[model samples]
Target: MSAIQIYDTTLRDGTQGEGVAFSVEDKIKITRRLDRMGFHYVEGGWPGSNPKDLEFFRQIRNERFRQAKVAAFGSTRKAGRPADQDANLLAILESGVCTATIFGKSWDFHVYRALGTTLEENLAMVADSVAFLKSRGLEVLFDAEHFFDGYRANPQYAMAVLRAAQDAGADMVVLCDTNGGTLPTELKEIVTYVREALEVPLGIHAHNDGGLAAANSILAVEAGCIQVQGTINGYGERCGNVDLCTVIPNLVFKKRLACIPEENLVYLTDLSRYVSELANKSPESRQPFVGTSAFAHKGGIHVNALLKDRQTYEHIPPESVGNKRRVLVSELSGLSNLVYKYRELNLGPERDSAEYRRILNELKDLEHQGFQFEGAEGSFELLMRKAYNGYQKPFRLETMRILTELRDEGHVYSEAIIKLRVNDEIVHTAAEGNGPVNALDAALRKALEEFYPVIRNMRLHDYKVRVLNEKEGTGAVVRVLIETGDGRKSWGTVGVSSNIIEASWQALADSFAYGILKLKENGAPDAQAP
Candidate 1:
């Protein structure tokens, strides 16, 4: 099977998504990651659009990419302007990129009403832009904006636009569903038409408004399109674009069509998560293939089936995409959950061992009181290790006090005093912060760093608090889920109490405890146990 070219639009189109902003350095890192992962092309941002993009192109020029070719993206020159004299085209040439992608009007409405130009003029703009870029000795891909909608309105005119690009020495003509309202069946038919009408290979760029972007992109490929354009996690404007994470596996594993190198497929999960981290967006757990919950099983029947044969519940091996199957333990979990977890945790306890029963009972009792363990793997792991493996504490908590006051700046300031003992050495520290949690976090670091300086890199990644008993008013029990990270990976710890402060302290302490255990196991330098 011929390989389908994977063109990533993350730096350009993906940034259009809400709350998605990448610094120049971020773009550079992502570009290098994609290149290393063996993507065919990465659509760098348009140099004419922003200074950050210009800087990115400038910075990226000196770096050597592994396999991916960098392509600069911009729109066709303004109506009635000569292609050579167009600032947008000039920016693409000046971007020092070997490839350029230029989008032009395919819909008659955009040509007549939006651009205020004739259909003939729009055709000339598309042709002249492609020819001009190609003349500069650059590979050019033409994006027929809203081609599906245009084809539905005037099939002749839309086909004419694609032919215009093909006649102008374009390398490929990509059909775009700009509004993302087209269905898969419609996209397939139009892609077939393009194959029959023009000699150029087709690419698909579909948005997710109709929840059919991935479907449409794949359907077009099955209809003979050779390239697919999308973002890592479907990051784009509005409903976002088609997710490449979903499409690549489908193409390679299901369709038996090669996209990225087989070895690079294992990096899919990490790439999806890395892009989300750089964008500062929470990874969607339910996202297919690369999500945390993609291969996670919580139900008894599913876990039993998974243990017997992973094929029973999972479509493919999670490791194929750099993901792992997770057996989430909860009220819904059963014996199979324990059995599966033992394989990973290497716990030596038998099915009905005293230690196993004790841990299980503790979990059930705590869960009965509104503690959720499904998302608190770090806390649960700490509990299991201490209960079964005789895990030792590195430090002992002595006492803590908090005081809140109104400052002269009309803001509330919180002060925390923390005392702890490490190896018979007592440390006391006080710190002030904008809030109680922040103050506690600072004071804990101050008191602990003297003994466990390794914790200096640990920081809170996310803090979520939920009320468990709303009817209890101010005395309602609350659950806090604190996610902490030590620069590499993040883990969640949970706590429950009627007093929010006490609950927060529990979770925060567990987070630090987990970190301490990790450091001890890995043998951290300049740290001593109490």
Candidate 2:
């Protein structure tokens, strides 16, 4: 099969997703990144829709991509408006992009109700739009909006619309599953029929309302579509568009069809997360292929099978997509988890020794008390290290006190006093913060920074608290997960207690200890114990 073309619309259709908006700079950054990853086309946005999009086109005009062509997106000329005179078409021409993607109503229902125009008029709109763009020496991708629904309702009219664009010299006539209601089986059949009917190259643009956007796109490619249109992380209106992240891997690895270069495939997970960060959205941990938990093994049977052979639990090597296999230790974990993790961490432990069994029992008991280790590997590492002989703690906490009071100014004031034994010295510190936990963190850092200045580089990245039993309400046991980073990498530590303050302190202390250990491993001079 020929290589499939990837068209990314994250800056265009993707912004239609709720809470997704990008500055012009953000769009340009993404364009360069996509180009580096070898995407065929990047749809900048609809130039005529908003000032931000128009400004994006203006700024992007002076930029050059390595291999990817930037395309300006817009709708067909308005009803009764000449293509040359239409503002939307004129804006596309002014955008200075080499290619233009214009969507025209393909469904009879959309033509009458959405566009409020007759079928013949909509056909003329598509034809005129494409012919005009081609006349301007721009490659035209004529998007047949709602094509699948159009075909279902009025097959002849939908085919006629595609034919109109083809006759008007469109480079490709894209079929869009606008409502995202099409099934893979029927979608493949429709795409096959269209591929047989149209002379122009075929493309599939799918939405994920029915959760089959990736499946539908793959099936469409098998049915002879040469181009696939989607957004990074599947960002789009409502249920989202097809995720190029998911589709690209499946096509390259499973179908043996080419999309992005195989070497570039390793950066797929980073790209997905980078886009999510720029969009101010949390990465979906359960998303296939690129998700954090995609290759994580939790069950004992699964881990045991994986210990002997990874293929027993995984479909592909995690490294193939730039992801690592995670062996999580929990109450459900078997000795296999401990064995695998020991190998991973290079911890010395005999497989059949009493110490190993003791550690395993301790882990299970802690988990039974609501200590989750899957998301808190740093804490788990500390637990394993503590079991080692002749292990010395960097610091020992002596006492800590927190006081909070509401002042007359309608603000709460919190202070923490902490005492610690660091090496041979006694350190005492007091600090104030907006909250009790923050105050404690400040006090602890104030005490430790004198001995381990590496502690100064570490700060809490995220802190999450989950109630183990909500029925207990105020007295409920809480599990606190704290993520800390030292400007380079981050680790998570977990703590559980009925007292929220104690839980936070446990997680916080583990975070500091883990950060110090990591720094020492990396050869930081200040990371040594005094």
Candidate 3:
């Protein structure tokens, strides 16, 4: 098997996505992570295009990389200027990197219309730029911009551009599907034609406008391309670029291509999540191999079968991608599902005992009331622990009242008063907030802290409310999911009720319960527990 190279452009093209911006610090962090992940090349950014990218190339000069080579991206020289004198070409050469990638117009329409240059002039610009860069002892990768679409429009012109790059001594000619509208079959045909036409090694750079970037990249490789360029988690312009998370695994495992080492494959899931979190973007759940919910089972039958033999239902084992199998409990759960869930909670189940029935009945009742146990397994596990006499309450909630007043201008004021009992002492507190839920949570925490000072470490990280069975309209069932974190561990809890306030209270109560349970398990003394 031949070794395939992986080129990541998340910091460059990925940042071209609207509403997506990365600071220089963010670029350095992502580059370091990608380097450690064994990516063959990392396109930091286009130096000379922006101040931040220029600073990145300068700052990164002091850092050392493990496996990935940094490639500075830019366009070819202008129509009128010589390669060395062209500002764009000179900027790329002085970007402080030995490897540089330059894009040239392959489509004649772009040459005449966009660049306002003749076809021969465009070809001269492409060949001269590559030759000049090579003469300066720089590794030049020529990106044939819009190669696939240009081939469809005029095959001869597109082939002419590739020949121009090859004749100019370019290291590699990367075929780019700039419009991202070409299908896999079309890419295969075009790549095959280009591979046979040029003597230089071929590379692929695909976009995801049609959501087929990964598919098209793999197809291009199968058709004889040796290098693939993509982002870590499909982060790029428009629909995003090819997701290397999917492409790497598909090539190494599915297609049996030799690229990254087998041990490096296990880090895909963590690397994918780390990049998403750093970028402050939510990871796609349906993303091929590394997503959180990719191998998760929610249906009763599926969970049951997976518990018995995961291979019976899974395409690839969860561990293969560094992800664990998760059995989600919901309204569709059965006895086997409950049994598996109980085992995960470390609570032994008595198959035919009344306690088992009680637990199952409690879960069903909670589900009917709008509690999604699957999404709030931390809360479910706490419930099981409390039922098994393993949980100790941190503080007691004696009373909670939310007062709301609507102003004439439609502004609203919400205030809450909370009373709690801790260590045979009662504490009362009040707080004002922008909303009823916020005021209630604030007052509750204030009252608890008055009795147990350690409660100050807890905070609400995320709060989500969903209307269940919306046909009920204003009287519809409401489900609240509260994610609480204390700088270390984070857990989610769920609650449901017809009134939004009541649902929020249920989730808030579970948040405290889970937090207190964790503290007790860690051997921290709960001053309020009796």
Candidate 4:
């Protein structure tokens, strides 16, 4: 019921996730992004662990952030090593950050097994580390590593570890669910007990191995934890940390607790995708709140209710989190789907018109033929426009040929020759590529660039091919979905055919057509639609 501090460790713990890495520049950029979005703390990785993180702290040391304090993360002093002389503790002090977060073993089993230190020495390490950092005038957050597990194993020892840090001037004592296996109810009860026992402010750091990091984090907050530490998009070691993307909104909108600035919530989706892009990973399409399909309606029944009142299907306005409502048309779509799309497009037949019904029937038939429009809104938009009287394609493909050659030395080459009629003028071109689809794309662009020069701005960003019927094997119908972008925006177009090349060409052609229409809408020169 109070303001919850959001501590993001995406640049630190997030990189621990397999296949997730970011350059020092990426860390700086994320820091700036999180600051602008009004996060309370941004963990800048352990300076003593890696050179990149050390370089990040060096570069970001002088940069003044608006709202977030960049904390340098490291573990408490090593056993028998004085906190002042410890390399990890000294690195945190040298990082030039105003805040420091240091973790120490809370679980008694970790003391003897992992650290090979006595229980009393572990407590001394926690106390000495916190006191030394506080003496340096840094706001220290003491992270009780494996706190939940420790409390469950030896409740007295875990409380002693936290008390040592608190009595040594730790600004905040953070409870960590390192293994991410704590149930929500158990976590809530434990955190509530800890809250009553400790005078220091409490924070929750949860992992997602058990898939309850987000839920446990929320419960911890309900039970009196004031801060929630997590990573963007749930990126972290093993399963992941709690996803701040999911946590922030739930706290802000549901619990009526302030996290980030509510106005900044509109940028959450873009931030999630931006971080994913920098991480060089594909965004999760089904991720809650910020995913592409978060607010997408596919079934006809859902669309019908959504058309009347979006609250019937949606929990919140998609725009609130920088997402949009999508109504997908497929074999399952009814009249309401067409009605919603037609209204959104602002160009299609009336809801009561026969043309509307015809288009709906055609959409269903095409989907039945393995042409999916759910992920190919560009193709669906094109279908709606083509339904208009006298609508013509910008260019007509006259003929195309592909040749693939493999030599004895194992070198292979593919070439495409294309002929097109643009404004009734013949354009012939040939191009080579790594594959037949790429060659065809190149050849088509080569022929069209002269007439519709805007085509040069378009490039295929993604191409996915799915076998419609795997049982048919070589004879199976294939569905090709191509995502194309014109620098500013992207759209998906789909095609279906038994021949892969033909299917690729269909999607490719639609992608170009849609790109040109988009360019024209934006007032790009020579981007005329036929």
Candidate 5:
């Protein structure tokens, strides 16, 4: 619906994901981004839960948010405590957030077993929490925890709980799939019923245990809910909440529901990658709308069709989200795929030319040898340039050596020496590190840093090693993908070898080469992204 609102819980529920721990500064940073992105609500955190969240509220007070309303989250008052005096409710008020959300029991079982209180007391807790918060000039939202399960068990009690909230003046009453097991159809039915009965605006907060969080949220909207609460990338406890990245695009484009301005949607991919980088997690390459591989074409027939009409392969234009179409080069690639790549890199070779055939054949040969060019766009570009432009090699390797030793106290140390020739000059360098790969990388960079000082800005971000054939055991050909960033944009290079060390070295060298080439071309291509 055009009246739909986007509520982001990334700072609160998102941190519940394993290995996700955002500092107060990080939360504030993300909050500012979301505000600029035009989210209607930003759930800061539970102030009573941790000092970090409390400090976030105090710190965010001075920062001006153009659009987002910072919301503090907490549970309803305890069974015996008064709403104004309860520590949890008081914390929400003291946080100075204009909006507060209080979660109360909607399930009969949790009321009797967990709270050791009557269902009537749970209802009082819900009503009083909302009413009390409203009296303090706070706009309150009430979360009916375990709403779907409670509805499935006793629809009457669930309705009563919602009525308690509605009568108490909550701005919105949210249905929570706390266990995340409800099917999309079930969610739709429950929400339809709630929408038909309640006069208050409805919201949906779904978890993705069944892989249906996004589907359920959409269905809930179709069934009449007007607000969607979710986390970026679906980051949360267990399977995470519905990913707003997927939901926002789905609503704005697919469903024709106005949530944010269409122009702002172009920043969707940029925001997704930015959030993942802040969390120090790689963006899922296959994630629906914003992932690297989402718009990538690999199969021969697919590429042929896509070249004629992208709609044959892509549901939406990649540029809609600030992502470009990627034609992955591999054994499965067809002539059309090579043509696309050649044009993208400005390689002056016609699709039917002999030079095009030569490069395509070489690519096939490389793929057969365990080279995965799909993730190594830099290496693939270098290959094309060398084949067609007679591009001179930037540097020559003279010699390299690495030694690993286990010393006293069970400590291990690695040392490396590298020798390189640049034109008429010879350069040599040595360095020690915690591992063989680290030492080699250090020495190689040291030798090259003098010649290309821009390499100093480049840092290795991620390294992944994959065995091509595990049946060959230790002798299996291994593929290494090294991701490097120069304080801004990141790129990858691939290397393959029977020796892990050799593979790592090849990838490392290519990574540096790619960084240098990119810097020479654009000075700093990624400064605007981060």
Candidate 6:
């Protein structure tokens, strides 16, 4: 199998996404992660654009990459200026990288109208830029901007641009679908033509405007392109760029191509999540191979069949992409569904017994109450414990009250008083915050911390609100999901109410209850049995 190179452009093109911004620190962290995942090349950023990119290139000197090379991205020098005197070309040399990638115009219209340069001058720009970068002892990749559409318009000039880069000592000539509107068949044809026209290696850079970036990239590879440039999660301008997450798995697992190390493939799912979290973007649930719901089974029949034979429902084993199979308990669950859920919790149901029906009924009731166990495994386990053994409560809610004062000047102050009983002791506390929910959380934690000091380490990491029944007007039901972390483990809890404040309070209370329950369980005398 031929080894294909993976070039990650997440720092440059991916940051062009709307509302997506990464600081210098974020860039360094993401680059280190991509390098560790065995990517062949990482385009840090355009060193001439911002101070952050300049600092990134400067500060990245001491780090050693095991498998990835760092590439600095920039545009070709001006049409008339000598490449040696162009500031953009000089910045690429000072970027402190061994590889430099420069994008030059391939479209005839862009060369004449946008650049205001003649065809011959544009070709000289492409050739001279590549030659100048190579003269500085740096490997160069020439990106043929808008190569596919330009080729479709004027194939002869497009071929000339590739020939110029080849003659200019470029290590590779990368054809770019800059406008992102090229179809797969067109990409295949043009890539084959360019591959035949160039002696140096060929590469592809595709966008996702038509949602064909990944498809076009793969077709280019099939047509003899050796390198693929893409972002991590398809983040870029407009629709986005080709997603490396989908491309890498497809090449290695489906196409039988060599790109990344075999061991690094197992970390793909984790790496995807890490990037998404750092970017503050939610990972798509239906994303191929690495999404949370990619291999999740919710229907009763699907769950039952998968329990007997996984291939009955799953297209690929979840573990193949470093994800775990999830049997979601819902209104559609059957006896086998409950059995699977119990087994996952390390519990067993009695044969033909009332406990099975009881658990099933409980799941249906919880689903009706808007407690989605599909994404809240911790809550599901709590429900199982309550149904099977009638587990003892960690703390009982004695009383809770919220007070909000709004002055004539529009200033508002909110306070909460919470009382709870742990074991036989009753504790009460009051606290103030910017909102009633925050105050309630603060007051409740204050009361619990006196008894369980470890509660100080727990915090609410994320909160999500959803309107369950929007047609109900003021009486519409809402669901709140709260994620809490205690330094080591994170769990999600959910609550539903007609009022938004009440819904938030319910979720917050569940978060604290779950944390206390986990602490008690870990501190129990029989905990050592595990």
**Best candidate, TM-score-wise?**
4
Q: Could you tell me the lDDT of residue 101 within candidate 3?
A: 94
Whichever of 2 and 6 has more TM-score, that candidate is 2
Worst 10 residues of 3 by lDDT: 345-354
TM-score, each model? 0.94, 0.97, 0.93, 0.98, 0.96, 0.93
lDDT of each: 0.90, 0.92, 0.85, 0.93, 0.89, 0.85
The digit string of per-residue lDDT tens for model 1 on 390-481 reads: 87566678998999999786999899998888777888889999999999989888888766788898999889999988999999999999
* Cα lDDT, model 6, residue 505: 75
- Model 2 bad stretches (over 4 Å): 349-353
The list of candidate 6 runs beyond 4 A from truth reads 349-354, 487-489, 499-502, 518-530
RMSD of 6: 2.7
| Range of the 10 consecutive residues with the lowest summed lDDT in candidate 1 | 349-358
What is the C-alpha lDDT profile of model 6 across 356-451, one tens digit per residue? 987799789878977777666667777787777676556777988899999778988899988888778888889998778878889988877766
Clashing pairs in 1: none
Tens-place lDDT per residue, model 2, 1-530, is 67899999999999999999998899999999999999999999998989999999889878877889999999999999999999999999999988999999989998989889899999899999999999999999999999999999999999999999999999999999999999999999999999998789999999999999999999999999999999999999999999999999999999888789989989888899889989999889899999999999999899999989999989888888888899999998888888888888777655565767789999999999999999899999988877764455688889989999999979999999988988878898899999999999999898888888878888898989999999999999999999898877778999999999999999998998888888888899989866
Query: CA shift at 22, candidate 5, in angstroms?
Result: 0.9
Off by over 4 Å in 5: 349-353, 471-474, 523-530
Candidate RMSDs in Å, in order, are 2.1, 1.5, 2.5, 1.4, 2.8, 2.7
